[model samples]
Target chain A: EAGVVQSPRYKIIEKKQPVAFWCNPISGHNTLYWYRQNLGQGPELLIRYENEEAVDDSQLPKDRFSAERLKGVDSTLKIQPAELGDSAVYLCASSGGFGETQYFGPGTRLLVL
Target chain B: QQQVKQSPQSLIVQKGGISIINCAYENTAFDYFPWYQQFPGKGPALLIAIRPDVSEKKEGRFTISFNKSAKQFSLHIMDSQPGDSATYFCAASVGGYNKLIFGAGTRLAVHP
Candidate 1:
């Protein structure tokens, strides 16, 4: 079975510019998640979606970051007016069901200058 | 608040030796614990997992030892090989929430 798929494996943008990352979850998976991993650190949950509804997004920075799972299958995470500190690997994962083992995507590495 | 804490930011073990990484969680509600291994430029993949009800679970050369009372758990890689070298992360979650709180991770290097 194909795992999760993400677009733009690497991205470099200047500070204050807008950046967006896309993710296509595993087929038939009901749970989709977005995580950010900094250098030498574990992945940190940014948002989680159950179907098309976002159940957990408390960690997302509302001021500049926003995410949406339009059809419950694909998701997009956006950071407007990005900052240098936003540089990190953005990972997308999906599971067959809630709380199940998740399969991850190749992640988009974002470098904000 | 970093619910889970992992030890030994980095470890170097000789081939055929045992490598152990430890983690502790603060949330008693966490019932499921999982370990993920990741190599450079790749996403993490699940290695092994354990529930609170069981004290131990073993899969091949990988073993997970859980201490319910202590709110701690550990991963033991027996007969470690260079191929086993990777960054290991411990994570915990409760109920049907897909949100997993992860530790700071431990990097293991097995020298042959």
Candidate 2:
């Protein structure tokens, strides 16, 4: 089976600009996640969705970041007025069911100047 | 309480030698521990995992040694190869496959 897929392998934007990243999960997966990874660090969770419902999103930065998973198969993460600190890798992952291993996508590399 | 501390930000090993990466966590509620490996431009993939009930788990060249009492775990790579060089992360989650609290990560480089 194909693994999770993400778009725009790399992106570059100026500060205060808006940017968006997209992801397509594996087939039949019910759980999807968005994470951000800074240089020399592990990925940190931003939001989680279980079948079109956001089950967990406490870590998301509501003031500037927003995410959506309309039908539960694909997801989009958007950042408004991007800051320099937002220049990191955005990762997406999915799992078949609860307690199942999450498979991650290649991630979109964003650079804000 | 949700932190997973990993040691040796970077490591250099020779091929046919051993590579070890260690991690510790303070969250007693975390029941599942997993390790992930990633190469440049690629996302992380599960390497090996261990539960508190088991002391050790091995898969071919990759081995996980769990110390429940000490709240520490380590990954051992036997006969390390150049192809094995990559960034490795240790993570923990309470109960099941929920949000994972990850360690900073350890970059391992193997020289042939």
Off by over 4 Å in 2: none
Q: What is candidate 2's lDDT per residue for B1-112, written digit by digit as tens?
A: 8999998899999999999999999999999999999999999999998889999999999999999999999999999999999999999998777988889999999999
- State the lDDT of candidate 1 residue by residue for A1-113, as single tens digits: 88889989999999999999999998999999999999888899999899999988999999999999987899999999899999999999999887688988989999999
TM-score of each: 0.97, 0.99
- Candidate 2 chain B weakest ten by summed lDDT: B93-102
Docking class of 1: medium
**DockQ score of each predicted structure, in the order shown:** 0.73, 0.91
